[model samples]
Target: MVGYSALMERAEEATYAGFERLKRDLIEPSLSRHEGRLIKTTGDGALAEFASPLAAVRCAVEIQDGLISGRHGFKMRIGINLGDVIVGTDGELFGDGINIAVRLEGLADQGGILISEKVLNEVEGKLDVGFEDRGEQQLKNIARPVRAYAVRSGADSPLTERIGVAPALPDKLSIAVLPFQNMSGDPEQEYFADGMVEEITTALSRFKWLFVIARNSSFTFKGKAIDIKDVGRRLGVRYVLEGSVRKASGKVRIAGQLIDAVTDAHVWADTFERDLSDIFLLQDEITTAVVGAILPKMLRAQIVTATRRRPENLTAYDLQLRAMYQYSLATRKGLAEAIRLANRALELDPRFGFVAALASLFHMVKVILGFATDPQFDRKEAIRFLRWASSVDDGDPQTLATTAMVSAFMVGDYESSIEMIDRAVALNPNSHWVWLDRGWVYHTAGVPEEAIRSFELAMRMSPLDPMLDRLCVGMGMALIELSRFDEAIAAGKKALRHNPSFSATYWCLASAFAHLGRGAEAREAAARLLELDPAFTISAWIARGGQSNAQLAIEGLRKAGLPE
Candidate 1:
């Protein structure tokens, strides 16, 4: 977590509302844009977590830069560190990770970020910031020695011109592709090597999450035996790709290496041997392999750096993480456990809108799947929680999207639901949840084509998303409404592969298979659905705002031998 504290004591003494405006109006949006989760906030400062050290530092820089140039009247000091943490049953954080960061915050100069050595090592050359290495010092109550570094924002770095005056690193994982060495000795083969570099760069740029440096800037290092650390500093990239291409005796060989320029760590290295026939084909093959290899390595590194290993002392964030795991199980037991964990998280921080929304989702799922003991209570509580979430943080796209779905499905307020969901989409078109919820809204509105398009778009945004099964189930339902039974069957099967226990997946399969008159398969799916959700009933579902094209699913389930 990054701890940021305002420098002005008068700012804290001002009206509480005025201080909150600075956080709500200025600081928080920057955090959201960088995928940081705000854990808590006092009148003068806040604590937040990012997926990686790079994101934490970047967000810190953005906050400081905004304070200097924007209307915000005060500067802030930020401290960041990486370490193991414990998750409490109630939502709160504890461990050296939290303690060290807060102490370091007090040590930072106004408008600058101070990072522990652990953070510096993970993000040194990856960012354009200069580091003033502060030697190891003993922190209060900390048993071990800790080294800290002052992260010089681009404003303080001499290389700021090469890095541009952006003042912050790119939000996504950024990379630079140096010119591939022409090792074949034939001057004519230089074109092939250059073509490989160009092709690899172009292919990698297709992923929206990747920021690829332009070919012109990358090619500047082509012939020189340059230090990649310097290259990373110059380009403001986290990873650098360098390779060599060789051709002889009708055979082509390509070797590529991906480096974490900050720590100078070799992340991934590979070599490929292929036939020289059809030069373009060989180039395409090598390009695909190199890009494929680098992406996974990058993802693994980011995930590992972003999240610390869970410890025995659980914080609110850790509790939420645990709840999400239970929720993914989508079983009766899992739903109960998920609800318990979510409620505990809310108890710890009643103002935590994200957790309130998640708990509401658990209740809504119970109501929809006929698992709730008090269906009416669950329905009303879900809407109440969602409304509270909206009141707390209306700018949160996920909360808005979830609120929209609850409004439509539980409150039967379609007009307000559509309005809220549209607002969410406008706020964040890149959010997969926003698209998925929009798909559901469209499905309930009987717009099958629009629903399919929204689902497909969600899949495109997050091809390997953990919630892929849910997306597939939604798409299968939409396909069934379109009378595309074959496609629906395929989608349902794919959903099952991802999450066999997801009741919706079985229901979708049963409906699709029954529509296709595959009686045996339909019966099998129906049995599986009943096993997971014994209380499920087509008539009950229809009674609870499951009208419109959903009748298609109800009719199919009836044919598959489910009770009316």
Candidate 2:
């Protein structure tokens, strides 16, 4: 009966049929099971009579839960009241309870259940569900005001349910950084405050272990005071960060506070004051401080949660966490264990696209690190797993970016790879993975400048990213292609400091040093590369495929005494 007027007038014929089918197949069965009898049916809703108020409320809950959780194509608002009523001989019920229920239903949100005080008093402590007291409301034609209570069904309540998708809270720590208020009383500094939040959000997202909502979604609440619990529920996040920035008399001050939104408990608060000598550097310093402060807190929180989870009840996400931890070890034994964990995760839930993509990336890593017994076979498996991941959820930027880069590197399908990665970037412009992966794709597609830009963007987005070595290596490769030998060598040296075992970084150093005519350094780097992968050769590089700009790298490698 709620919003039924527009439903009847605006809905198509099939919509009406679907509604009818919902009532026939779902509502009627639920009512029958609850021992409620349908007295009459209206175009949009129905009237029913139960033997007791408890039965009536339970039946209402069942019907509403069914319609809301099931694929009924529509949702309904339900109301129940417990009161004496007149039963006509024809079986139609006539009473103030019926009228009040109808009126309460109209007041309820779609897919909600509202009951009067009498019904709540009767059902209290009997059912597993709780009620949200909505306070007393004056009803039309009713002698007295009725106290209304909305049923609170855990996990299935209207407040929690989204359309066709359940809320996916982060398996690890999740946080949202709301836009910083500009308290300077100057409108021009608004961008500074907004940039501060964006930087923090971007920095946090790079943790890989933390789930940070994108700036676009978090900024929606800008300039609005909100309840932390409401924010947690709305965003499916457990923590929230809010702050303000003020700039006056050439001094910049930024203050931020992180809160456990669930319990409304303050986790941390800090303020930084510095002369605005260089605005960008000041922002960078603030970003580093915030990221540094939050990471340890989030890690402690994660450790506490992990300690609490029973081993037997480990979820696929838990397996993923284990897998990523092993992957981060970046050794042969670690890679093997990572693969094992990923396989176990797949066994538990094969439909998880993120896990599938992760497994695919593991294989890709095997190919790159020379860990596979048969590189071609591993390449094929990587492609197959990436395809599987895409089939599950192509919209996920992580999946798309990883899959796309794997396609480019393993299959040499740079055009299709770039297309997929572009889509990922479009889906989430703030995702560092998209930028990083697209850098590789663009480099292989013969666009060194574009590749460089993408890599720089990745660095900006995640200054402390665990994958910063990869970004440095990628930028070095692109710089080498541009014949910037010294710059490439510097980048390669930086990359080596982070991940000395990475063969690509050594290869970059060798090539750049050779091109710069530094024979001793070039030979030393080439020797290190051969130590890591003695079978590495120019022939394999040619077989792997590259763009026109790749000739510079090939020539430099040849000069560095690499095998052809």
Best candidate per TM-score, number? 2
Candidate 2 Cα outliers beyond 4 Å, as residue runs = 1-170, 176-182, 185-238, 247-254, 257-313, 544-549
Estimate candidate 2's alpha-carbon lDDT, on a 0 to 1 scale: 0.77
Q: What is candidate 2's CA lDDT for residue 294?
A: 63
> How many clashes in each structure?
12, 0
Model 1, 1-564: lDDT tens per residue?
Answer: 122233243344453555575675456555754557677776567887776787787667766665555554556788899988765654467788989998888788877778999998898787666899888868888999889998774554332242253333353577889999999999999999999987787666544345666565577687998998888877778799999999999999999999997789999888989998998877766775677557756755654543354545555555666677677677778889888887887887676677788887888888877778888888888878887787555657777887787777777777787888889877655566688898888787777798899898777656666667888988999898888989999999888888887888887889889988999999999998888888778877776564545878878998999988
The candidate maximizing lDDT is: 2
Candidate 2, residue 277: Cα displacement in angstroms equals 18
Q: What is the C-alpha lDDT of each candidate?
A: 0.76, 0.77
For each candidate in turn, give its C-alpha RMSD to the true structure in angstroms.
Answer: 13.4, 14.1
User: Residue 380's C-alpha lDDT in candidate 2?
Assistant: 82
